[model samples]
Target: MGTQERLDPQAGVGTRVREPWVTVVWNDPVNLMSYVTRVFQEYFGLARHEAEARMREVHEKGRSVLSSGSREQMEIHVQAMHGYGLWATLERSDG
Candidate 1:
């Protein structure tokens, strides 16, 4: 067998369990654009322009990844979004 065909026992050794997550904000007619922008700014501490940008992305694209991190962090973000009365959900990131 060629060297490339050999299995490396240490290939995945000691690798951290990275649990990627996605924060999805669904389209809801009830929330106002300004309110959404405020929520993004308040909850995530995003700058005014950045917050509005994400809000616009969500409004235009039907959804946006407000933030991404570990599962625990995502859960926190999801709950925070809920606290702001915005439609939000978390899912495993494909990456």
Candidate 2:
């Protein structure tokens, strides 16, 4: 089925469908790989293997998309990651 578009009165932008946003965590010198994996498991409830994989991705690739959803939700995820001492940011999902 086709997606529906709506006018956002607050932004005053033209009618458009809501786009997904993503929370990205960047590799940093401070947090260890184990810590990153644990954070992913604790905060995002990812399985151990999945969390480790994502942690490895950040370690090897510099960053990883940890979660995707509404902009507000992604913002929350980014904020929470910051609270955990992990560098994080949110952006519009490319796909």
Candidate 3:
């Protein structure tokens, strides 16, 4: 693989930069809102309110961003969500 280099003004050394990836859950007719919230709580350890909020966002907005990190982690999350029968995907975060 070819390595690209750029001078870092702050560190004065080349650093590899990678785009952040995010796990997004999409609304689906198969899953109930309470079940979605429960899954978020069980998998992510989110508080009840936080989980409910995310579920609501998915219900109203058609999608909700659940987590963000490396591409590998995001992919793992997507797979896990699929295991739970929830519609999910990962992509490079736009913001």
Model 2 agreement with the true structure over 1-95: per-residue lDDT tens digits: 12347778998776756557889999999999999999999999999999999999999999999888778788899999999999999988777
Pick by TM-score: 1 or 2, better one? 2
How do the predictions measure up, each by TM-score? 0.82, 0.83, 0.84
Of models 1 and 2, which has the larger lDDT?
2
User: Which stretches in model 2 have alpha-carbon errors above 4 Å?
Assistant: 1-18
**Can you give the lDDT of residue 9 in candidate 3?**
100
Of 1 and 3, the candidate ahead on lDDT is 3
lDDT of 3 by residue, 1-95 (tens): 11246679999999766546899999999999999999999998999999999999999999999998777888899999999999999988875
**How far is 15's C-alpha from truth in model 3 (Å)?**
2.1
How do the residues 1-95 of candidate 1 rate in per-residue lDDT, one tens digit apiece? 00113334679444444466878987799999999999889888999999999999989999989878777788888998888899999998877
Candidate 3 CA-lDDT value: 0.90
Q: Give the TM-score of candidate 2.
A: 0.83
Least accurate 10 contiguous residues by lDDT in model 1: 1-10
Count of clashes, each model? 0, 0, 0
- Where model 1 places Cα greater than 4 Å from the true spot, the runs are 1-12
